[model samples]
Target: MELAEKLFHKSRREKLSSMLDENSLVIVLGSTNVARSYDDGYKFKQNKNFYYLTGFNEPNAVLVLAPGGMEVHDEKSKKIKKTKEILFVQKKDPLRETWVGRRLGYSNVKKELGIDTGMVNSKIGDVVADLISRDKYNKIYISLFDLNFLTGEVKEQLRGFESSWITLSTNVQIMDVNFLLAKMRSVKNEFEIEQVRYASTVTAAGFYNTIQMIKPDMFEYQVQALLEYHYKELGCQDVAFETIVAGGNNTCILHYNTNRNKLKSGDLLLIDSGAEFNYYNGDLTRTVPVNGKFTKEQREVYQIVLDAQYDVIKKIKPGVKLTDLKKYSVERLKKGMQKLGLLKKGFDVTKYTLHGVGHHIGLDTHDAVANKSIGKNDYDKLVAGNIITVEPGIYFPEDAKEIPERYRKIGVRIEDDVLVTKYGGEVLSDSLPKEIEDIEFLMME
Candidate 1:
């Protein structure tokens, strides 16, 4: 079986046993795309939540598990559960296969996906009705919103069952399973970590290729194209997100993705981009001088961002709160700004310093998870095997007249993917040239 298939079964079993009530039925549905016209159609990626649970990457699939029928009494006075994992996938369509590609048919899915049973999608309505017909089940656990494809079918099945109909009239439960899956995916397993590492390696290679091809007169989008081309050449199907190739003052816009400006000799180029592999992503940002060497002011601000990054890395160990790390980066940035005279002595750092120092990185570039509060002792502590990015930046717009002329129109950010560990945080993207001297050397070479 494939690695993704194994992960899918394990995650599904864990979620079913942990989240479902003793006599509840759970249904997980995926999205589908309908044809706009007779000839045109849209492609669909499997829902991340559904894919996490079943590793069924195909569209138009549903997973059903019944908690009541899954339990068995053990001689040791324990109730051993035997949850049935059923996958309903699209039936084999020879015509469609010729146009698109062959799907893992029902028989292949059962053997390869490690599911107890497999059925064609056409039988989903009846199967769901039968599962709800069992009076022992008092509640149904299904994803409430965003799964529009199966909402009507699910509601129809519930309405058809007499017991469910009676319960719905009064107060039968319809529990939402989204939060349960979110919590499960928040933590990274060994396999997930390895996949992220591979993504990071591919992203770093893309960055290297970009550096070699970049010239002062080239457009920012050209640099972006270079990185993306390398990403594809190295096997990444797409970028983790829109590539940020902001030049000069444009870098001040943190989420800048319109890479249209022309690179100049004195301008600093900020490239914040990543590559995705197997749905895992790597986020990396590096600001370099377009002329292959930073001017005095650019170097000063760049070094400060570098120092802030180093400070966060030095203290990022198990048990450190993310909030503390953010505070530490802010303080370091403030101090660095004061040293360069960009900020006045005792000025509030919050006015200039914005955006969080880091975020969880994985399936999504801005991967969703619970965030920690600043100065709060109750915040979640850093744990080993967690993958995150420490991105510290300072943006000074061209119009800002508060500081030296040399420093104006400068935006500097240094980012790297890190793996939290018991001993310390390991920098996964250390291959990128970040140090002032090292960056210059790489550019010149």
Candidate 2:
């Protein structure tokens, strides 16, 4: 990591420490591996909050942050020091190292992660217990997710803190660390924006590649594979979320990921997928005709969704409420649908205009940010550095008798990642074509 990158993590830690009240400690645990089968396990992914604070990747690591300084013995230095931050990492094991990847090893924590103190995780359990029992800190803030999935020495020592890391463990008031982390993660620094931008950039390339290669008779999963190839080919860890390559009637299913159907000439494909770059993610959705040409009815419906999306995106500056934006998009889509005679006075536009206009996209594709629920999302205005998606979709299932045969089984969703700016919204995935003419030209090429 560069100096700026290292400073980013350090500054976040400092800011969080400032947010803490005196006589309190915050404990956050990183993620551990899960077994895919009996022999091997899935890839280890560090908790986003932990990574934000330390940029450390190793699992079974615990981070302890005290508002005021605490005196602790540093094994590597063999000296007593006052520090507010301590990291407990795995001890060195040559055999384990040979089988799995190398550990950061506690001794290198300060140098590598910039934490003030480092200790082997083996002693963390007793250390935490001793501190709590001493009554020095009146409150403890721990990551709720980690508290549930505790393991190793920490779990053994704090065993039964299950009600809260250990059932009836201590008198200290326990609080969740997620609330603070959510508020902090909601905004982006320049580095985080760049991470998402690059991810969106590559993600756009992935869509660009997939749309051109798609043809009648190709399996939907094959298009998914070609799209995911952009993940590895463009320096990404993986797809941030499941690649939704829904075709024909499958497009109406909001969270559909069963990409097994064979594509037909007239059927449209709705792809809502993203790529992960450095944990920050890029979410995008684009619906294109499998035959490389949209019939007149298909073009009309696509235009309605596209125009509504454009109307919503233009209002994305700071101080604008997302819910208001969502409501506005809903109204705009209804008006658009009304023109097609699809939305009448009695009909609910929601049947076709499924989902909100957009959402904040970051560490997770749906992001671990604030105001996830439509009406109650953070209840705060969007400030600059907040990245969001603008996706307005219309889905029409084939069975709907009210719909014309040509427009039935037609679903259109146009999505792009947008960074909320002081001036206006900047589309990060601009490199990928969204205009109907552009898409058709690319397919022709």
Candidate 3:
């Protein structure tokens, strides 16, 4: 990380510490390495909350924030009083380091990362037990996900410990800390905004590279591989989520990942993918002709989706709720579909539009604070620094009887990343051409 980036993380930790009560303790657990096979494990991803607070990516670590007046025992058994933030990390093991890589082992964390103290992971349970045993803390904020992270033996010990603690202490309480982190993460700071911008740029470049190389008879996975290869070569560690590259009718299947079909001349290809940079993510989706030219039916459906998406994005600003935007999108689509004679009597949108119109994008592609409900007015108000995706899609299955035969097996989705600003929404992905002529022209090049 750059010096400025390191300072940004340090300031974030300080801000979190300031939010705590004087007698409160916060424990955030890092993610563990999940086994994929015997002696092999999947790539470890640190908990987003832990990373946001500490910027430390090591697995099996815990960040403990102790506010002022916490009691501690010194080497001589003397009672010491101080406020401290401690990082409990894996103990130094020469054999393990040899197998993997050198661990930042229990030293200089304070000097390097601005943490107050560092300790071995083995002593975390004992140290935490001793601190709470004194009844100094009135409230304990713990990651709810941490319970799932414990090993079997450690979890058994924790169950027993909780039972004993419940019997002994009436004032101490455990509370979910994720809500606070979610609220904090909902708004992007300057540093986070820059990272997301870079991610979006890379994502767009990858899409352009793939679209230029796309042609009839190319397998769907080949396109995905090409885009991902471009992303990795540009220094991205990993994708934000599983890459979705669907061709023709496969695009009707939301969240599809089986990129096995060979592209055909008249079919459309839908790709939904994103890149992660410095832990922030960019989500983008684009549907284009397999032969680089949209047919008549494909163009009609694509135009409706594009118009609906544009209307929704134009309305974004501080205090605009996503639910309102969704409703507006439905109305826009309904009117467009009706004008095009796709609607019969009622406005049943599920026939064409399948999923939600948009979602907040940040640390997670579908960010933690993105409103998830379909209730009429249930949603979060957009705020400046909030980054989201405006995606509107229409899918027509081959077997459907309501639509014309010419429109069958067509899927079109136009997605773009937007950032909420005081003036309105700034389209972060505006550089990527969504206009039909622009796309065809670029493909020609």
Root-mean-square deviation of every model: 5.2, 2.3, 2.7
| lDDT (Cα) of model 1 | 0.77
Tens-place lDDT digits, model 1, residues 279-306: 7899999999998988988888888899
Ranking by TM-score: 2, 3, 1
Choose the strongest candidate by lDDT: 2
Output the better candidate (2/3) by TM-score: 2
Worst 10 residues of 1 by lDDT: 70-79
Indicate the worst ten consecutive residues by lDDT in candidate 2. Answer: 160-169
Off by over 4 Å in 1: 1-12, 34-43, 70-83, 148-171, 345-348, 372-379
lDDT values, one for every candidate = 0.77, 0.85, 0.81
The TM-score leader among the candidates is 2
How well is each residue in 1-445 modelled by candidate 3, as lDDT tens digits? 4577678777877787788888888888877778899989988888888888778888878888876645554322345636477787777889999998778876756666666677777767777888877877888888767765665333443454566666645777778888777777888899889889989888988888888899899999999999999888887778999899999889888898989999898899999999898788888999998888999888888899999988899899998888788888888888878888988886487768887788888888888863544455334788899898999888888887888889888878888999999999998878788888877877774
257-346 per-residue lDDT for model 2 (tens digits): 989999988888899999999888999999999999988888888999999889988999998988899889889888888888876578
Worst 10-residue lDDT window for candidate 3 reads: 72-81
Ranking by lDDT: 2, 3, 1
How good is model 3 by TM-score?
0.93
Q: Which regions of candidate 3 are displaced past 4 Å? A: 73-81, 152-165, 370-379
